[model samples]
Target chain A: MKIEHPYLMFLGDAPDELAAKTAIGIKQWRPEWCVAQLSLPGCQADLGLPEMSIAEAKAAGVKTIVLGVANRGGIIGPAWMETLLAAIDAGMDIANGLHTRLSTIPELVQAANAKGVKLFDVRHFDGKLPVGNGEKRPGKRVLAVGTDCSVGKMYTALALDAEMKKRGMKSTFRATGQTGIFIAGEGISVDAVISDFISGAVETIAPANEPDHWDVVEGQGSLFHASFAGVSMGLIHGSQPDAIIVCHEPTRTHMRGLPGYKLPDLKTTMDVNLMHARLTNPDCVVAGFAINTKSLDDAAAKKLLAEVEAEFGLPCVDPVRTGVASIVDKLQEI
Target chain B: MKIEHPYLMFLGDAPDELAAKTAIGIKQWRPEWCVAQLSLPGCQADLGLPEMSIAEAKAAGVKTIVLGVANRGGIIGPAWMETLLAAIDAGMDIANGLHTRLSTIPELVQAANAKGVKLFDVRHFDGKLPVGNGEKRPGKRVLAVGTDCSVGKMYTALALDAEMKKRGMKSTFRATGQTGIFIAGEGISVDAVISDFISGAVETIAPANEPDHWDVVEGQGSLFHASFAGVSMGLIHGSQPDAIIVCHEPTRTHMRGLPGYKLPDLKTTMDVNLMHARLTNPDCVVAGFAINTKSLDDAAAKKLLAEVEAEFGLPCVDPVRTGVASIVDKLQEI
Candidate 1:
């Protein structure tokens, strides 16, 4: 089950020039592994030469071939499957980045098993590379938020982390959840809504770079696990805050209708939810942004804000208006 | 580019078993092509001999291998990919089935292209082997629906189809969208809420089994694009019936907070959405069902029914009470 000599071969929509770039990313991430991208002839889309390419890979001493297939209609089509089989015949172990239900293909699985070819499904990783030291313990103070799969929650987290750095605040982005948490530096006022959600009572506090002592918040509910919820509750109980700021996609409705919950129009519901959190934590301030508001007009946007103010009875602001530049300023003033 | 003596390999979860089954399914679907499942040595999950199996597969004159990888987190994971690569190294053509975002796997894509592996993504085949006569027609209709994917829409369609059959009605499940019109049959109904949302039409009739025809309905409002809204509308319009039966998860809420649309409590909202559809189609009798009600007591069930009747002003029945068999019987009588 262990590969003694493994070489990488790229397939399906694999850019010729980008092969080096990929090798770089992999090397950067896993420096211990001797990884190099193997090129094969007849690999171009126009040539459609599956068998010839596979032969080239085998000749190049490539023990492992990574194949890419297209994603269409929420699944992969048939063309890619034909090519993958050709490579297997050419004597190369296969790894695929095809967006199709591979479970449906039985013959391929059996063939690989018989050959002792190790297959790796790449979709689960979803741009997630392994991080942190292998020996490190799992960190605490984790937060998980529910979000639309496409929303750039990760990007927002990165921006927030940058803002924290500019303000001389020590914070770390917790990568376990859909988005990371930014721990604040000293003398930073925690938003009431955030404080309440965390159950932390703090007059003024800052985020920590390490997970050992930091406030963790996430945007998507799907990523929220019971253990994470318990950890959040523990953090909140341990440190009460003056305010809490929640970054979420307002329009996305929670699925399957949990008890005592109503599906909300993505925009208004987000505002109301944030406001409700603020109401529960009177000493906290709540802020939210409509992640999908690019197409929204001024009038529609104003109405959404008004509804939030009316429902939650709290002062609210958009993340865009405050901007990443002013995060330190706002934290300092608070 | 032609694969002269192409060896196709299937790889994934239970690679050996899946490959065997798929070879059978494919052969049955397309008898014109000679296909066989190949087994490799040491690929079995049973922890048996590895070298002997590989030798046997090669001896069988198996030219290709297909891999069936396991599905994880709504997509394929890494183990399957690794296995497929191993088979390619052992001299086999690879075909893979792994679904979920593969755009990020450049190395894998390159290897497959370079190795001339015929990769196939099978998620869109709807569990049916694709057997076509090499003919392409414009606007060909393909209908795909699942019971779980559309919140029991498939079951609802099946129930309605059964009802129609029982009535001795002559109806064909139209494959395409542009088929000639026919009178809506018994137990067919329109989904008013979905219709209103998509086409601005208060009601749109739908037939059984043709869940893909929702695009024809005009005048639906913004809610048409809500998750499963298209399927809902298609079910309504495709039926094109004199009467409509609405089946849905009882907890779901449709478009919330439109002007003059008071936000109903979760229970009330579900009921009202159904009722609204009934109101939109005055000529249709709306029968509704709440799926997955095995846990409720008689009293609780009655209360739910009462609430629906009170809110929607329609006679609604539980599918459980009118057992599936009984309903089929009634449809036969009609």
Candidate 2:
């Protein structure tokens, strides 16, 4: 569902900045939509926006209160209920990306229903989607695949979208995860969809567009990660991309959360991604590479990027350090 | 949840044999557990069993009534509700594999709860399951993967399990779909699971067992099918199969339901299945091939099977016509 814009960023008793990373991401990518911040007592995170109460947010024309910050267990804390109710009473929709569904809370559901405002659970998708048909949709798509999950795929996609816009290119950042959903106003969390409908949901998310337009679809889960490769495979096939950007994190020795599992090398990752992607788009090509060099020094990061680019004969960059200009340029050639 | 046996198969006014195929499957595989058949007025299908009413079934010690037939939209007909209530009133649990959940019918739910009998919605799974860890568990696993959906993966798995048992081997058929669940009496519909947990649900379905024990896990969808490769990938990873049997219906030219897409060749299918399967079990091997030669004459099926065996250097047979004797023999070597 489309979450309304001009939002109030909610950081409800967040313990640290990391807890509010999703809110920060929204501000980073869609600053105009982040009108103001709302926080409860003892909240430690801040978006550097002028804090507002429900009345002030409503008066300021905030249409939705986005519960982007997550605390322990990703639950809606008891301390946040009054604030949520007040926002609902003020005729503001609530969009949440937490483990607990807002619909599961009777009080919140009743308040939102009574006020005729919507509750957007960004992590949950409850719409009827057709099964993917692998039809040749009219559009250029570039999916950011990865060597592992949480390896800068989202950031790379956002950067590419931003750079393309700066160049007056028709491009849209397609979100497939919670943080990405907050960054973009609307997108499905593909991983939360039923297994049978993963590809279908992705197909719905990006759909067909102008022949020259590019849907830079954000990826999820590594093909090598045992926990989530299924989601990755579905995303690859449904995207039917003309090109894919391979994302990687250099310093990770093991797969995230599975100590016994090692991440596949960049070459293996790209090769596997291409193999599955070609099922839907037989001409899918490797557009570029996105590396997360946060753990490396500048020299090391530069050395690694250069080596990878030379070896693969593709543009490579850290979306954060290098701004993905080269990758966006490479996308033009594809 | 374990669906109790000694079931009274309900074919509620099924229009034809195909409409009652799932009930037929249950009777074919678990005949001893099928006490009798119960048909409504206008039912055209028969399982060649004595027809019984709810009172007769209860008197004969039938513990469950399995609604194993489907109408046009897979919905439960209002006409069947009376019979279902009657069964529940007689202390019989209900197990259904339909689009309509038994728990959603307040009347049946109320009756079942009052009678202290359970209602099983086999197509739905509502339990806690951990994410697949891809750990090396002790067991010999053989997974039956297919070229597309409904290409006899379940039949092949069941055949393999039956053959293994006939030869005094420790084997079990693990179901992954509704028909298979009816045959096996218990299973989680992997495709129905959330995308993130497809593999995890499978892992739970076939947990650790004796080193010599075999979990003949039935497969779903295909890696080449755009609509459902996600489910296939998850099944492959979660099986951690020591060996995989490739099932194919040679007559089909296109991937199921997607007329624009052609099925991958057997070699390509095997290679891709192995590539994905290797993530969980590095030592995974192709055990054999199970072909659906239903459309071919006996001689043609035999010749085709021989040719495929020669091409792949693996044992190949039609599970229905020739049985899986050679495949079971091949499994012994692995």
lDDT of 2 by residue, A205-225 (tens): 999999999999999998999
The per-model DockQ list reads 0.02, 0.90
Query: lDDT by residue for model 1 over A1-334, one digit each (tens)?
Result: 1222343434344334342333333233233332334333433332122233556656756666554323334343355566566656666666544435344478677767767665544332222111101111122222222222324334444455556656666544433221121111011111112111122211112232353333333332221211111222222222222223334445545322222223334344343333323222323333333233444576775576567556655433334533444333343343
Number of backbone collisions per candidate, in order? 180, 0
Backbone clash total, candidate 1: 180
TM-score for every candidate vs. truth? 0.32, 0.98
Evaluated against the true structure, the overall lDDT of model 2 is 0.91
lDDT tens digits, residue span B307-330, model 2 = 999998999999999999999998
Least accurate 10 contiguous residues by lDDT in model 1 chain A: A178-187
